[model samples]
Target: MNIKKIMHVENLTHFYGNQIGCKGINFDLYKGEILGIVGESGSGKSTLLKCLSGEISPSAGKINISLDQGGVKDFLSLPEQEKRQLMRSMWGIVHQNPRDGLNLRISAGGNIAERLLNVSEKNYSFLRNTGKYWMEKTEMDSDRIDEFPLSFSGGMQQRLQISKILSSNPQIVFMDEPTGGLDVSVQAKILDTIKSIVRDINVTMIIVTHDLAVVRFLTDKLLVMKDGIVVETGLTDRVLDDPQHSYTQLLTSSILQV
Candidate 1:
């Protein structure tokens, strides 16, 4: 079977003032494939993610993404309103910090319901039941549905964010350091939950993380970036186990040494 390319990014480059964010990046994400972008800090992983997700516009590039309805679109060239609609409808983003993705003032269920609402879901019973279902899927306690996310543990809050993002049934998700800033145990649980959920859904994902273990665990393809460019790209196992690029080798060695 021919793989369907859901997203194609070519010559994607961005700059923070004069500093390069990402330069000459090109990649294609297939339907239901999880792609990982791994690099050290300031290597432009986050910058490239933001550009792809449309949180920030790049200096120049082409981001051709297939919409849920039909046909591919250059999201960067779309009108602001259309872009905003696309983000809410067909795409989801999981931020490194849970606070960046969740509305602290809202109840846990409310947060999930918000995404459903954005997609024009108005039936209260369906929304409520879907919210509970997602909470359960993320390994979160369904009893805490009415509680505020701020009252939940850090790990639980992250799970809530995941539930919210998945509630809308997004075709694609962009995750930046999904397991970052948590203890070893917490990170392991979160990674397991993410891996399990992605396996059960037909969602394509592009995740940016410095964690080699995360790439190995959750991604099918991997890109190793250095100084704003992708230095290596291949099967996750091949690239991680036998990296060809010097930068990729150095990165793997440094992680192993730690």
Candidate 2:
């Protein structure tokens, strides 16, 4: 059984003037698959995620996405308007900071409704109901649908952000440190909710994090990066259990010591 390939990235490189952001990155993301990019700070994992999610343009490389409309298109080649349309309809991004992804002044349900609106959902009743449904689905209380995001706890805000993104039923979701800065217990619950939602929705996801435990618990495949390069790429268990690269070995060993 050949799994459908949802994205193909080749020789992806980015530069910040004289500095390298990420270099020669390559990977294929398949439908319903979860891939993690892990590295320490300044490893360029975040830069790579930004490039992949269209937050920034790569200095060079090809990112081809299999479109639902029935063909592959170079994501980097699309017009700005088209890129925005694709992002609005088919791709979702969850930022490390929930505030970055959400509108703090809006009601939780309104935040979700805004995404639905972008996808051309016009019925007010359906939008409200969908928001309520997604809130519950993400383990958030539906009763707080009318509350502003600022009133929610950090964990709840993150869950609300997830609800807003997933409410549109996007084909791909890019998460940058989804559990970052939260309490360990909060992170655990969010991770569990994320895992369950991904499985339930069968949506493809690419996550960037420094936590090996996050990859171990949530990712099917992993990429270990150092100095803007992918030093190792393999199944999560294989890479963690028996890392071949020195950097990867160091990463795995550090996790073991903790």
Candidate 3:
């Protein structure tokens, strides 16, 4: 893939009062690339997502995003309404739990169609057609489109959550622990499903995960975090196969040991 920075962060810092979550993080996410973040808990992985998404503004630094309009803007400096609009159509965040991402009361298709409702200058027919197209693309059977999220298995629910976000066609997708809490076999399937979707659609992804094995399966590049800081980052193969930073080496070693 031709490499260019889709999102750039420089001098990035996040603080909760006196305690820092992540400090001076500089990185770039390329188009059609899967960037993995691997770190132990409390390593500021989730905090970075919050900062980037504008859910909680960063204490300091610049986040520049290339807009579809052929312009760039500081995502951190945007007005509240503008940021909210950006999130509704341009960006997506998938939580660790499928249930957390989906509405239990709604059918799978309703959950997938929520994005269209948020920006519905279009008619009802457009939304319905779009929903069914995405459902089929995500490997969801047509009959199950009307089923409640509660009725699906964990893996199925996760696929539905994926379908929900992909239907919006976000420029970037940030996933927090995409395979957490599932057994090894189920986790692998989830990872494979996600990889297939991203490859098919060519969306950039930033995945924060504790599981290095999943990272290997899903990401093209990597960033290793330690104590609210980025210790290292590079091509996934380079970092895992031959890490330079001590902390990164330690992380890869532990994963290899397992």
Candidate 4:
């Protein structure tokens, strides 16, 4: 059985006034695969994720989506309410800044349960138990889950963000540098936690990061970009070891050799 493409984009183009965002963007994310996007700072990796996650709309082209519910829909053209429903339950996004994405004053449990409340809130014990379970799944202490987000370390907060998003059980995950600016050891541990958790649930993920090490560890397919256009895309091992494009070779070389 062929896994229908969960997400699809064709000839996607965007603009901020006269500035080009990305043109001719095309890709398909299959079920249960980690698709990694890597590019320089201004290369539109973040922009593309935003588009896919419905945070922003593209200026042109179509985003066709096949929901698990047996409904086929076009993303770029949807009623605002329908879009909201899709985003709230079907798509999980972890922005680059953990602080920007989460409510800092809310207890970590509240943050995770926020989306869970969307379905049904009649059972309080079950909600709390689910939240507590994910905190442990993220390797976070259950005792600290009731603490405010501001009280946790940066890495811990990122895990909270993941837990919050995952609690909703989105079919597609859009993660922007979920493990950046942390100490190497912490980054490794966080990646390990993410890898384990996402795999166990068989979730589809698209992570945009400049870190090649992250790409190697978290993804099977690699998409490389520069100046808002994809230069190369292939299996992770091939793209990293024997890149076909100059930009991809440069990116592969930039990684710290083991």
Candidate 5:
């Protein structure tokens, strides 16, 4: 089956003053595909994700997105309001820290409804029902709809964050270390929920993480970054099994050997 291309990035580059964040990065993401960017600290994987998601502007390059409503459009060239509308309507971003992505003061259901509100969903009963639905999908107890995220565990908070984002039915999601701060058991459950939800919804995603096991489990395609450049890119299994780059070999070996 042939998949439609959703995003095309060409010669994307970003810098922080004199320091390189990412340079000459280019890739294509297709519908319903999960692409992983994996590297150690300071490797620019996160930076690349930010540039792609339009959280930050790149120093140079073009980012074109194929919208379901119409033709391809330049992501960076869009006005701030258009970009904001695009994010609220068609895209979602999940931050590494739950606090960063979530509003701790609001009830879990409120958090989910917030996304709906952003897209101008108004019916109060409908919003409540949708929130309850997503909570159940994320394995969260709907009865706790009124409970604030501040009282939840790290894992639950992350689950709430996922539920909130997915509730919007976004075409593409950008995640930064989705399972970064959690116990192994908790992380496993969260990951399973994420995988199931994405599969059910057929949402495309770009996930940035340092965990090889994470990328191996969640992504079909992989990008390995080092020193602010993509050192290798290939099918996840192929790259892990027979890495073409020395850095990639070291990464896979170091993780598996641990």
Candidate 6:
């Protein structure tokens, strides 16, 4: 079966003045596929992600997205309002820090409701029910819907953030180190939850992280980056088991030694 392509990225490059952020990045993301970008600090994985997710503009590149309204469009060429609408409706971003993705001042359900509201959901009962449903889906406590995010533990806060993003039923999700800064057990649980949720929703995802284990567990395809370039790209298992590039080989070996 041929999977439909959801995004096409070509020669994506970004710079911080004279410094390279990411250069000549290219990839195709398919519907419901989870693609992982892995590298050490300053390898340009995060920079590439920010550029793709519209958090930052690229210095040069083309990002074409297959829209739900039945057409392909250059994401970078869209007006700011159109980009914001796309972000609000079809795209969801999960930040490395849960606090960065969530509103700490609002109740947990209110956070979910806010996203639904952006999508033009106006029924109060439906919004509350949907929020509770998503909380349970993310393994969060539905009863805590009224509680502030600050009152939750780090892991719970992350779960709540996931619930809020997924509640709107977005087509694509950009995850920046979603499991970062968590304990081993918490990481494992969050990863499992994310895997299950993605499967259930059939949402496409691009995740940037340093952990090889994360890519192994959650991603179907992988990109290995170094010095602002993609050094290798392939099926996750094949790349991990038999890395070709010197940087990729060293990266896989280092993880084995850990």
Give the local distance difference test score of model 1. Answer: 0.92
Which candidate's lDDT is highest? Answer: 2
- Residue-wise lDDT of candidate 4 within 91-192, one digit each (tens)? 878877899779887899998888788766658898899899989999999998789999898899888998988988889888999888777888999999
lDDT of 6 by residue, 1-258 (tens): 988898999999999999999999999999989999999999999999989988899999999999879699999988999889878868989998999989888999999999999989999999999999999999988999999999999999999988888888898999999999999999999999999988888999999999988999999999999999999999999999999999999999886553
lDDT of 3 by residue, 1-258 (tens): 566677999988999999989899889877888888889999999988889888898889999998878677888888899988877778888888999888999988788888878777367677777778887776777678788999988877887888888888898998988778778787887777787888888999999999888888889999899999988889999998999999888887875552
Give the better candidate number (4 or 6) by lDDT. 6
Candidate 2 residue runs with Cα over 4 Å from true position = 256-258
Clashing pairs in 4: none
When 1 and 6 are scored with TM-score, the better candidate is 6
TM-score of each: 0.97, 0.98, 0.94, 0.96, 0.98, 0.98
User: Against the true structure, candidate 2 has what lDDT?
Assistant: 0.94
* CA lDDT, every model vs. true structure: 0.92, 0.94, 0.85, 0.87, 0.92, 0.93
Give per-residue lDDT, candidate 5, residue 133: 98
The deviation in Å at residue 8 for candidate 5 is 0.3
lDDT of 5 by residue, 45-76 (tens): 98898888878999999999999987899999
Worst 10 residues of 5 by lDDT: 249-258
Residue 154 miss distance in model 1 (angstroms): 0.4
Among residues 3 or more apart in sequence or in different chains, the pairs in candidate 5 whose N, CA or C atoms overlap within 3 Å are: none
Candidate 3 minimal-lDDT segment of 10 residues: 249-258
Clashes within 3 Å, all models in order = 0, 0, 0, 0, 0, 0
lDDT of 1 by residue, 112-158 (tens): 99999998899999999999999999998899999998899999999
In angstroms, give how far residue 142 of model 2 lies from its true place: 0.3
